[model samples]
Target: MKTDSTDDPRTDVQTASDPCQTNRDHVEYVGMHVDDRPVVLNLTEHERLAPDRSLDLIRQSRPGFEWGDTGSGSAQLACGLLLDYTDDEAVASQHYIQFRDDVVSQLECSGPANCWHLTGDDIEAALASVTGHEALTPDGGTPTPSLPVNWSAVNRSERTVFQRRDIDHYVVLGEGTEEWLLLLCAQGDRAYPAPLDIRTVPIEEDPAPAVRELVAESNDLVEPEENA
Candidate 1:
């Protein structure tokens, strides 16, 4: 399973190696995290499907999307993703959908992005989990994702992730009032320091400590190295 690092919009039909054409519930979705909260993201995956490509393979969603002046280093890019949420109380549902088609699927991130399968169904599930479930705090657009959950937190049984692993970005769903969180399936790079490999379900599962810790250490997470 070859995975591109440049996170952007990408969609394709079933692959040749896929055993079942109808759905991936058996092999694709290996485990599940469930919650009864407002913006729940019950992410699941087939342990074997996580792709095996590196960061450079990722293609930009558009022209400018591919490059980086102060990019997330191959390491930072491959490091944990910031689990940010949307703050728009009155945000349109379409925005979250676009987030799926655009960033989560596009802009490449290593850790979280590597493990997720951002299909159309996953996008809808993410949206339906949130929306009008919590109070809206107008923090502008998506809230800053503070959680730096290790991108690679699964048994590498020599199996690729369900979706083509060539894709770089991961699924990051959001809801109105900016209630959202990133997911965890199994998935990173190197210049930024390696994050602690903490395992938790996507924010949808609502692990208070993990979320709080991510928020606590959010400031220390990777960013493009600064130039002098």
Candidate 2:
């Protein structure tokens, strides 16, 4: 009695020489972090996708791609992976950030030689896990409106102000009778409109340490103009 080829387990495996498998879409991605740099390869195409290509499609929040943390680098990596995997700009733009926060941030490599792998099916499943409420628009806007802050309502006294000698940028730290506020402002001149950045912390028993820390962290604050 002869056995059927259809019933053979060896026939189930796909090889590069198989004509039926040759035309199939490439779905496998391999990622590695080597020498403090990230590398991603499309195994099917036998080509590497540059991180810069992804940054070109989206505004770069970080200098480069990274994973295993919920930082700008991880976000960049997430965006790049989606764009590379789907080859759809709109799909990548709309879903990348959420995907970064959910999946990419959790990818960890314990050792230097360890590499990560992802498939088209894995990407699809991750995308599907994104809830409707977490989706962003193609333009990257959230559906909900941000509550407006009224700066005039706060009763604050200027504790100290740092002004950049070369420009109109200022970092001001203020103290209310009950709380503390920090304001970073760029005063507008003929070329541009004024923009304000504000941060606040509630008053604890002692505000000295908090004020000193805020002052230390304001890198934009430079030495004040002499005598003025």
Candidate 3:
């Protein structure tokens, strides 16, 4: 269930010639696929704005979002309201399909719809402002990191942030009965590679506090580093 973060194209820039290749500039995205490639809604512009009540809060700041006729439906899904429980299934199903198609069309018109397509330097600036974690490529999106000096890190070899490997939303995304009705990924999308993994990697959870508790207990949860 847990996919390696390094498998992601955006996070994994390493090559056979450059294993130590550091992540240069990562722009976080909340997107889906179009035409067998990733069609991203680059969220770099809306880094300052929180998705409190509405995804609409950041639509204007997005890199390129074509608010087509079905744009309102996409917005509705993003805000966690697809349809009422009492609403008829046939109508909801039809609406859902149309909304996803509109998103795909809009994405294609926005820019080159590719997974590794970096938006530009402007996005990098926005990322620089919000990336709180030290390790960027694979860990830039990690919500929290333990203090290096903390005792919980006694077992750690290199400085590392806990990778967010848990993803529950995909289960919901695939489920026809889930409250959230946005079909961000199709069945084909899951087979591509690490983009699905990267998208699912949970970024919101903070691991520092729990790790701190283990430190207090003198429990080294991880293998100790070999002495240099």
Indicate the residue-level lDDT of 44 in model 3.
Answer: 43
Q: Give the top-scoring candidate (lDDT).
A: 2
Model 1 segments more than 4 A misplaced: 1-14, 19-116, 133-228
What TM-score against the true fold does each predicted structure earn? Answer: 0.20, 0.48, 0.20
State the lDDT of candidate 1 residue by residue for 115-215, as single tens digits.
22344354345556543243222222333233222221222233211111222222222322323343322235543333343343432123334444443
CA error at residue 205 for candidate 3, angstroms: 35
The backbone clash count of each candidate, in order, is 37, 0, 0
lDDT of 3 by residue, 1-228 (tens): 443555443343234333323334543333433333323333443322222323332221133322233443343332221122113443333233333233322432222222332233433332344333332112343333442232211112433322222221111111122122211111333553232221122121222333334332322323333430
Deviation in Å, model 3, residue 185 alpha carbon: 45
After best superposition, candidate 1 residue 45: deviation in angstroms? 23
| Predicted candidate 2 versus true structure: per-residue lDDT over 1-228, tens digit per residue | 453666422232234543222233647766665555776666667677677878888754546777887766777788888988888888787777678878888876532235565667778889887645332111121122111110111222434554433446544667675566766667756365244566676432223344334333433244433442
Error of 1 at 63 (Å): 4.4
CA displacement after TM-score superposition, residue 56 of candidate 1 (Å) = 28
Error of 2 at 111 (Å): 7.8
Say which prediction, candidate 1 or candidate 2, comes out ahead on lDDT. 2
Candidate number with the higher lDDT (1 or 3): 3
